[model samples]
Target: MRSVYMQSLAYVDANRIYSRIMELGEIGRTKQSGVQRLALSKEDKEAQILVTKWMEEAGLTVSHDHFGNLIGRKEGEKPHLPIVMIGSHIDSVRNGGKFDGIIGVLGGIEIAQFIYSNNISHAHTLEVIAFCEEEGSQFNDGLFGSRGMVGKATEEDFQKKNDQQVTRFDALKNFGSEIDPARYKESVRKEEEIKIYLEMHIEQGPYLDVNSHPVGIVNGIAGLSWYTIMIEGTPGHAGTVPMNLRNDPMIGAAKVIQEINEICSSQPDQQTVGTVGIIQAFPGGSNIIPNAVQFSLDLRDINLTRKNRIFAEIEERLQAICQENGLSYTIKTNIELDPVACSEEIIDVFTSIGKKLDMDIPIMVSGAGHDAMLMSEITDIGMIFVRCKKGISHQPEESATKEDIAMGTEIMLQAVLQYI
Candidate 1:
């Protein structure tokens, strides 16, 4: 099939798009004028209801998967063809900004809404989704919905617990999801079922904001490796155990954690980054020595070779640190993936449209993680980024102009229509 060429965009209701974004924000409005709609929370349910209403009004047939991802379908002239999928998550962090994931969903809906209202003829069906728990703030695991959709979610994902001591299993049940937690494989969409995937999101960094570009094309998302390192040592009384004689896991953990920073920073301009997001020491007492220490390391980089070498160096140093401190250790690789490149075909469409629109579209490699990365496992993926103020995101101050978002939507609309 060939793309349907359009000399101009049929229409994109910028006002309606902005209004919907603000409307969704009102559901979990925080004192800081942000959103706290964690996945499966009450606020998330409220937002889902409102979004569902909007989807129906936009002429979509909406339904919920067993995982609770809100999916909306718009049938095309040819319904059996692999679908063109677009959208992002609606669930936000504890106090996230209004536009992070909201733009992609609303933008995709606007495209679908336009196609339906204008009665535009297309050969492939269009699908929009507001994936559940992309923020993962509730269950301490992000990308739950996207991963589930792609069959990448692991057994450890659904078993994770929240701060309230509630397992994800119970939380999904409370939220009206038909998930068994043990076996929710029905939600996975086969690679052949999707033609391509697209998403629009805030830059979440200052590149575009600093360059004063309203919209940017994402070249790719960085690869990431997550490791849970455990250090074990003999427990003893802090007062009685001399520092020279004690086998201390905390000492080993501290040394390894510090090395993680130094190793990733070795190549400063390479964009290699490593962070220890979590740390825990057992026998939490001022007078007691920790018997074990557990910590999480998140390493990411656009260059896979650099990322791997850095991780290897960290592990090498970790072994030395453990041996020096008389501690035994284990490393659990929770997740590891190579960088995902955007679909060059879809990317060319965006760039052409941007040039036609007289917009300067910057191509950037994402340093942060995104659901688009997982979609890469199944289908061609493309991402458009709208500039947020100062590149701030995941907080109350995260801001993206309605005009920028509309501009990105217009580009997406034109580009997606080409595929039809």
Candidate 2:
């Protein structure tokens, strides 16, 4: 079938989009003005229900899978053609800002509403999805909904437990999802059915704001490796133990963290980063020497080879530090994701549209992972980023101006029109 040419242009209602964003924020609103709609929780379910309602109001047919991924589809002029999927997740990290995942879903809905109201028919069907559990804040399973949609999820994933000691199976039950394994397979869409996937999100970093760019075109998503390290040592009285003689595991942990920072910084490419986000020293007391220390290591880089090499060096240096400190250590790797590159064709489309619209659109790599990375496994994917204040995200202070969001939505609308 031949692709549909652009017949007319449509505009997005920025006020409506912003209003929906604020409405979704209220479901899991935090005292700090952030959101805490963890996946499969009551807040998340409410957010999903509200979004589904909006999707229906937009004149789209809504459906959900066993994994609870909500999909709203608007038929195209050529129903047999593949679909153009546009959306992001609704779930948020603990105390996450309002725009992280909310914009993509709502932005897609606004675009759909525009098209429906204008009676502009495209060549392929348009689908907006509010994915479940993209933050992994609740179950430690990032991209849970996207993975299931792409056939990358397993039964074991459903059986995983959360902090409250509740399994995903039970959580889904509580959220009122139908848990039939046989029918769950229907949730996975065939790759051939989807022509392209588009997502819009906040820059979540300082790049766009510092450079004074209103929108960012993502070229790639960085790969990530997560490791938990535990050090064992003898606990003793802090006052009685000599500094040189004390076998404190905290010392070993400190040394490892310092070396990791140094190693990552030493790399020629400054894109590689290593962070020790979580740390715990057991037998905690001012007078007691800590006997055990546990810390989490997060490594990210667009280059997989360099990322792995850096991880290897960190492990080696950590082992040496433990040996010298007379401490035994164990390392456990929890998650590893390879980098995903965006579609060059889609990038070119966005660039061409930006130039035509007289906008400054710079292409950049994503430091944080998103559902777009998972969607890349099945179809060509592209991402548009709106500048956030100080590049702050995953917190209450995260924000983007109405003008920036409107500019982003305009670009996205034009790009979809041109591509479809």
**Per-residue alpha-carbon lDDT of candidate 1 for residues 1-420, written as tens digits (9 for 90 to 100):** 333566876378999999999999998999999999999888998998888888888889998776778899988788889999997989999888899899999898898888777777888988999998887688766788888889988777777898998878778777765445555787889999999999999889999988989999999999988888999998999889888999999989989888988787779695998989789999678788999999998899999998888888888999998888889999998778799899998888899998899877999988888889999999999999999999899899988887888999999888788876
Residue-wise C-alpha lDDT for candidate 2, range 360-400, written one tens digit per residue: 68999999988898898899999999999999999999999
Q: For model 2, what is the error of residue 209's alpha carbon versus the real structure, in angstroms, after optimal superposition? A: 0.7
RMSD of 1: 2.6
Q: What is the lDDT of residue 86 in candidate 2?
A: 94
For model 1, which pairs clash?
none
lDDT of each: 0.87, 0.87
